[model samples]
Target: MSHSKSFSLQKIINYIGGTLIFFGVTYFVYSNWLSLNDFFKIFSTLGVALAAYIVGALLYLNKEYDEVGSVFLMIAGLILPVGIFIAFKLTELITGINNLSVVSFSISLVAFLLIFFYFGRIILLLFTIIFASLLFFAVMELITTKLNYFFDDLIAYQLVVLGSSYILLGYYFDLIKKYNLTGSLYFFGVLFILSGSYFLSGILSFDSTLWKMIVGVIILLSFILSVPLQSKSFLYFGAIFLVLFLVDLSRRLTPFFGEAGWPLILISLGFLFILMGSLIFHMQKKIKK
Candidate 1:
């Protein structure tokens, strides 16, 4: 086959495969809509598996590097089923075990180590560690039956953990620069930020003063970092977060400013929105140029 013909064929295959995978994930997620907890487990397992297969198939069809593609497909196939099974078994075990906390910790720890060995990537390894650490703490909470500082602030804990995980994953992508892998990393980064915001809100629980300020700063910083990385999606998302932060800040300081606080805050937010929007637009133009 001529090189041009081969490239065209590969592109077609990639397009078709990607469309199928997208539909499959949409079906999976839509099937369990409105029930996040019930659907997410199944969606993640099956969706990831489908995505992996599609990616592998695209790579194979492209004939760019069949060997590497095969490896990726195989890993995806293997991990999807196995991870789901383990999750189910762990859920069952957690129910039966007298020391549920210890069981959870041990399982997460093992999973962490296994991912490190199998993936053999520093970025993935760090994510595994963060996941394990969160699980460890969650288990500890269960064991002690204490809903004290940490448990009381589940949102904060979840945000910090998930956000940290994404930051690490993003760092990893920055190092590797593989197109597919970088796409996944960016997806995860956006997800973490959105989830982390909810967590921050939960932690604030009416006392939004301190938490709002902290999260605002975090959101601004996240936007700045994403710009240089050429992640328009994250930059835009961060801009949205910046608005939310300002709104929260204004609401918190309402007592001092009285009725004027609302308009002032909105005006401030409008300015920020324009500023960040301009920055993102300029950054993207620069990259293209």
Candidate 2:
């Protein structure tokens, strides 16, 4: 077979094998869901996770079957959260404290963190951090609402905190030479922070100039970050958001300019952007040469 054909066939076989194994496991456990107690369900799944991790670790350490070992360990990581979720819910049920999802997700985050500690897998760490922060904030909101301590801007502020923390954490990882941690963290980091900041601006009812300044600052920061991270997503999002801010600013200020200067400002901003792009291109060319 051709190389491309062989590669494709290998992928197909892997997918089929994975699906069959998963389906078999699911089929066995699912029918017993109603029949089994929480303890039984939790322990059985954890037993499988433990077995997979031990065998996978031994194989990985031997270095002869690294790929198989990695696959098995990843499988164990994937299975762990299900077991944790059940255990957390069981705890809450016994204690009569509600917010089961939040508690379960929090425990699941810890499970992923433990796996990351053992394996040092970047994706695992990133997802764990992301979900942990989100679940923490969500639980806080839930509790505050239950206790009648909720405020109108509380969750928005929490979102902002979450976003800023992600970005800072990404930078911290980068400084420590953890390169694998950057891409996903930065991508979602920008998403959450920017959206949160935008919402905050609306809630705060900032002046048009202040809004422009905020967007401009982030756009510049993203551009600066893109150079080091080599991430086009950051640049693209920055450019997109800058344009959106400009358009929104123009729309809001149109009445003050009696509609004539509104279009004029748009045209002016367009020319300014084009000029900036040309300058950046020339500067890059000069640096490269």
Candidate 3:
């Protein structure tokens, strides 16, 4: 077979093999789950991970099949989180501390980050960052619940901070010579920030003026960042959200002007676009001159 065909065939084989392994292990575990003790149950899960990691380590250390070994190691890393989660549950059951599982998960996140960094995989690092952030939110909610800090809008504010952190980390990665990942990080960052902003805007919708201003600012900032980053993800998202924001603003103002206000805003926006375009054109021409 040709090289491309060979790769495709190998991929197919790998997928099929993986599916079989998954089903076989799942069936065996479920069928035997009733008879297994707690210790056995916990260790079995962790043992698979440990075994995978050890074999993968051996393969890579020998350098005979480095890429395949790396794949196995990656698989082990994926399963490590599951084992950690299970360990967390066991700890919770034993300690009887309602939210102490967060500590277990925190440890897992730290260990995974260290292990992935040692392995030197940017994609894995990205996955870990995204996963750890989700767990971070989970921990936040748990702590808040224990502390009785329930507020309807608290989650949005936290999300805004989290989104800002992602943006900062994206820039940090860019500084370290990982340019390709900045787009992914920034895209997710924008998504989270915009989401939080939307929620906050909804909560503040009683003030119609503020709603329009908030959404307009989001659109402007998202598009502005896109210009410097040259990221299509931000450009497209900003455009889509701008339309949604305008529609929402129109809907919120329907009590004041019925449907007429929508048309007026649309027309004004059109003229504003024209004016901005002309100014930009003139500026570019002047700069070139």
What is the overall TM-score of model 2 with all chains considered together?
A: 0.69
> Which is the better candidate, 2 or 3, if ranked by TM-score?
3
| Residue 115 local lDDT, model 2 | 66
For model 2 the local lDDT of residue 230 reads 59
lDDT-sorted candidate list, best first: 3, 2, 1
Worst 10 residues of 2 by lDDT: 280-289
- For every candidate structure, what is the RMSD over all alpha carbons to the true structure, in angstroms? 8.2, 5.0, 5.4
Q: Model 3: which residue pairs collide?
A: none
Error of 3 at 106 (Å): 1.7
User: Can you write out model 2's per-residue Cα lDDT over 1-289, one digit (the tens) per residue?
Assistant: 8988986676566546645655665676688888988777776676666676677667766665655565555556656555556666665653323465576567658766776787776545655785588577758867886897858767656766776777788778778987576666677778766666666566333444564477668777876766666565566666666666666666666678774976788887889789757745544443322
Q: On a 0 to 1 TM-score scale, where does candidate 3 land against the true structure?
A: 0.74
Q: Ranking under TM-score, best-scoring first?
A: 3, 2, 1
Worst 10 residues of 3 by lDDT: 280-289
Top-lDDT candidate index: 3
Supply candidate 1's per-residue lDDT for 66.
62
